[model samples]
Target chain A: MRFDVVGLGVSTVDLIFTVDELPGREVVQRAGESVIAGGGPVATALVTLARLGAATSMLDSIGSDFFGSFIQREFTAEGVDTGGLVVAQGRTTSKASILVRKSDGARAITFSPGDAPELTPDEVRVDIIRASKILHLNGRHWDACLHAARLAKEAGVLVSFDGGAHRYTNQHLSILPQVDICIAAHDYAAAFAGTEDVAQAAKALLEAGPCVVVVTQGAAGSRVFSKDGLDFQQQAHRVDRVVDTTGAGDAYHGAFLYGLARGFSLEASASFASAVAALNTRALGGRAALPSLAETEMFLQHPL
Target chain B: MRFDVVGLGVSTVDLIFTVDELPGREVVQRAGESVIAGGGPVATALVTLARLGAATSMLDSIGSDFFGSFIQREFTAEGVDTGGLVVAQGRTTSKASILVRKSDGARAITFSPGDAPELTPDEVRVDIIRASKILHLNGRHWDACLHAARLAKEAGVLVSFDGGAHRYTNQHLSILPQVDICIAAHDYAAAFAGTEDVAQAAKALLEAGPCVVVVTQGAAGSRVFSKDGLDFQQQAHRVDRVVDTTGAGDAYHGAFLYGLARGFSLEASASFASAVAALNTRALGGRAALPSLAETEMFLQHPL
Candidate 1:
């Protein structure tokens, strides 16, 4: 495979501000600190993989605006190839303004969905997907996602799906059959299965099509189930402090895929993935504190 | 005079998001609309003048970041010269993330003051200040503001001081004597005079050395007082809608200065300023709906 993993999703520029409290009325407050960074579920995941020494490629249509430039430059700086990235002229790129409370790490997000059109099915980079060991997606650019997943399946490339929280829908069920590995937030799993039971949700997800299924509940831990009858509960890794939890799930998905590519055992893969997610919370922005392979290994060894 | 007006103040990039209501806790809301615009007291004032067919220039130190580029581009597009604008290498430009309530145009602002160093007194463009018919300032880059005001006075240029609401300080007293025109928000005037009486505040401001003094009250109208004993209350112009009042005061300052430069009488100038300020509130951003000379004249004649 030319690349370890290829991702298709929306990319955005995130401007985060730290404030005393969320405003409930008219007022002007000073930010304690602020940082601007590139953000998106699958985009951040690909960045996580690249930081852990995996070669990854991203495919998406972005505007030619400042935010788009920011997103593209960030990918290049992180060693994530943008050969399949499309630039849409005279359009505004997606951006989000997130305000984080100072006393506690709660956030209020106001996102602007830019005017850039979504990628069409024909816009999918078939060659990139066919050349990758794994094709990861989160149902963004719905038609294109379905097209890319089918193409990856035909080429014998693994298909990974990430079901983010509050993003479950009936349309997602139609694409699950082609997904080889399915990892989802607890809310997504429960919503998809029409039940609150994690075990029942995992069982339903496994029966649908993925050979392996994992449902993650942040801070509590995650449960992994596979068709081969191998099952285990992975404890959440402990961190000295968690500055922000913005992209923790995305980090897990990326690190877990990295583990599978490296041929690690499923149990070891889950543990490594948990550590990577925990470590990502030590900084403000999603990609700011991504750990390298050496750093992750050293952290696992020290267990602190 | 080479230019009608020269401005010395901070310039910022404002990202305004219109939300259903202010967020008081952890929540992710979709913005009804979003706009990114260049903003500042004196910068907007100059842009207002430029839109009205006046030659204006801006002076300030800004970062070589995205927001800085935006500020510079906006000024150029509006026909405002930026020869005195300084670009500080490797610094972040000041920006504000404003969440505006959709029900009413109330807003909550969280600003990030960038790390760019302040423009020093020596950095003030002496030639630009000396050539302009009027030099305008609002105490930004304190030392530079003072230097510019003194140079404008020595060169026989009229000095205008904008006392924005919540922006008054005792240090401003030192620069007041050089000012020929002093326009202030009612709150600012009251703060300076240590009294809320409009007549008394205006009288006190005239005694502080300005030949003309005006105190503005939004929606209610503005009261103008002069050292020559001319006094009048100019009623605010009524607009079809008031989308946002972000830059109304600044617009008034620019149009008032424009009127003075065109040799209009004090009462006529105050009425023109009021009309321009009211018309500016017809759009979402400070500079979005700024009127040109033709638009302003048409609106004034129509009286709606």
Candidate 2:
């Protein structure tokens, strides 16, 4: 099947530990519940799109371990094309042991990046990129993300990026020119702009070549700056009880890209994206609770 | 190093998670704290012996995986010999994901016995067993435990056994007659003896060739039956706080064996073992809070 979006980044098997609250130093506590699932920025974004009626494909590598197989199987089970996934041998797949506090749905993520080999420029499949309407990347594998972004640019596919306060490296900065839409956490954008203000950071990132820039602040909402005269600020959608906030940002990216792929206006897409993100926290992990398109629409119409 | 105790059993790497309370079916909660440690009945028992100044050796086959390396390294660090350890190729070592509830210090353990091959009679190293004064077994490896137990009996070395409520397969019954010192959780002893009473379980097990039979009940203490005119009932040792209860039973076995090795009277050994087991729960995991012989004695004199 033709792909609506192609995602490139790492995937992790997260051991979701549910505890009442953080324990004291050296104090041993029991976990109320534990659920294991696949999680990662771009990976979860792909899952969101796939679950929302988009034909998505993931172009990434997971190490050769149970976690690797677990991640790959999750994608396949979710109807996300994993044909482009490379199983790197002799390495442990990256994983996270995430602690989710039940009282307020706060989470602490501890991630271990296994020695899965980085994707090389030569390994980027141009045919796959050309067939996709959007090339979404989680600016982690700098060299490979840049390579894919350039290929997507040449193929007339929109290049969307996810940078969650993790784009300080020179490698990440080097990919800015190829990014058509750059969405980042408020802190990451602020750090990049060398200012604490969101609007200032948006302008700085826009001048760097992205057609649109967004800075998302959890619970407070998000800010959008576009070269095409589309600028707005939106509040986060309120939910009665927040189960978990993990991967909410990734859901926003996936939904926003989905909107763009469906020809929605930038402002409309951002609003839809915000709705999707709020709904993502209704359950655990990133993709497990992602909203379907119909669900997103209903939420937008009547968000309680 | 000459070994006073040679332990043959499976080892596991446990991911200890702390949660406030168990979540409903699919609810996700965060963990307050998480700890990784080496655990398993015989493995922890050997560590206890080593810590109490006994020269201990482990004879087992663990898979060629990170968990295997972790378990082996932990034993080595604690002065338990790993030279007799065989690195089984193309397999994964056993592991457990333990959730500890802080409210009552209750724990739920989920164990995965990775494809680590069970030890065969041929794999039992007589030389190592001959060098040890005691041959300790966890009673899981049916063939290997029986082989080692027989060898120990022929060498006049005492064979100590550990059985939890988990001896499901009838294959476990074959190891009973070879065990000179049989210590088990109350439920397991009850099941094996076809009675719910602890005293009946202890009496029934005595007929199975064990010189001494002990049925341990958590928080309620333990019961001892022996052919050497040693029989008694001891109350549980009390601690101010119970951080975790994982491996407490293993601590008891190790300390009990240490007492017998040191020629302590059976009653004295049972009292010492209870003290050590209680101390084990003052911290996380089984091996972390194991006390030295001196400490156990001191605690007996004046328990805090």
Candidate 3:
């Protein structure tokens, strides 16, 4: 495989503001800090992998607006290949205005799904998927995602699925059988399994398809289970300060995949992923505090 | 005078999003609607006057960023002159991310005041202020606002001051004596007068040097008082729905000045201003629903 991971998902520009308090009514308040960064479930995950020295390519359609340019530029800066990306003319790119409260890193988001047309099945980069060791997706661009998953499976490339919080639906079941690795937020796991029980939800998801299943509960930590009788708990790493947890889970997914691609043990992989996720919360945006491969290794060794 | 009004204030790009609910914790929600428009106290006010067929010029220092360009483009599109706008190379323009809840037009704003240098007294555009029928200010650029007010006063141009909600200060007292008309939010009036009584606040504001004083209370209506014994209550016009009130007060100030410029009686001006402010709330942003003179006249003839 030419690339380490190839991702198919929506790309968005996040305008994250660190405010003193979440406003309840009509009021104008100054931001403590502001950051504009590229964000999306798979897009941010791919960036995390790239920042960890993995070669990754993005697959999606974005607008030709200033935000589109910003998204592409950010990917390029982070060493993420955009060869499979499409730019729709005169369209608006997806954007999210996120207000994170300074006290606790809690956030309220308002997103505009831009008018850029979704990537069609024909627009899927078959060659890119076939050349990657793994294909990552978050269920955006339904047709294109399904098409890419089948293509990756056919090519013997590992297919990874990220079930973000509040992003699960009945339609996801059809794609699950093709997904080789499934990582989900606890919310997605419960909704998908129709059970709030963590172990039961993991078992149900494992029975559906993927050899491995991980259920992430923010701060409390994460649980990993595999069909081959592997099970463990990965404690959430403590940080001096969690400035924003906007993309912590995404970081974990990317780092976990990086561990697999590097042939690490499941235990080592989860530990590395946990460290990466913890480090990412040091800044105000999703990818602002992404640590490089060496930094992650040093952090893992130091156990921060 | 070559211009009807000259304004000295900061200009900003407002990214307004209408969401189902303001998020209290970490959550992503789609916006019901979104709008990108120019916003500022004096900036929106000038756009209001220009839309109503008054010649207006804006004087401020904005950045050389995309937002700065948007601000200038908006001003030009609204027929407000931009000859006095100084584009500070490579600096960022002020920006506000506003989330307005759908159920109510209540807004939560996170503003990033850009690094654009404030306009100095030398950049006051004296000729523009002298050429205008009215010099409008909201105490943004301290030195420049003071310089322009004195210049307008010296040239026999009427001086108008807008004391926005929570925007009053002792520094404003120095500029008040030069002002001929003062329109203030109830909050500003109370702060300035150290009293919550509407009548007393208006009287105190009038004594500060403006021959005329108008104290505005959102949704409740506004009270107008002049040193010459003209007093009246301008009731708030009822609209079918209030989309967003981001620029309602600014609209009122602009329309009132437009009335004065068109030589309408004080009562007629307040009535016209009230209608304009109500109409402005019919849209999501500050300038989206600004009405022309004909529209205002028609609304006055048959109000909702």
Q: How well is candidate 1 docked (DockQ)?
A: 0.75
Candidate 1 regions exceeding 4 Å error are none
Cα lDDT of model 1 by residue, A128-242, tens digit: 9988999999999999999999999999999999989999999998999999999999999999999999999999999999999999999988999999998899999989988
Better of 1 and 3 by DockQ: 1
Candidate 1 local distance difference test against the native: 0.93
For model 2, residues A203-299, the per-residue Cα lDDT tens digits are 9889888999989998899988997767799888887767778889989999889888899988888899899999988877667678888988998
* Per-residue alpha-carbon lDDT of candidate 1 for residues B1-304, written as tens digits (9 for 90 to 100): 4999999999998988899989988999999888888999999999999999999999999999878888888898999999999999999899999998989888999999998999999999898988899999999999999988889988999999999999999999999999999999999999999999999999999999899999999999999999999989999999998899999999999999999999999988999999999999998899999998999999889996
Candidates 2 and 3: which is better by lDDT? 3
How accurate locally is residue B113 in candidate 3, as Cα lDDT from 0 to 100? 96
In model 1 chain A, which range of ten residues has the least summed lDDT?
A65-74
Angstrom error of the Cα, residue B246, model 3: value is 2.8
A best-first ranking of the candidates according to their TM-score comes to: 1, 3, 2
For the record, the alpha-carbon RMSD of candidate 2 to the native fold, in angstroms, is 11.0
CA shift at A153, candidate 3, in angstroms?
3.3
Off by over 4 Å in 2: B1-13, B16-181, B184-211, B214-304
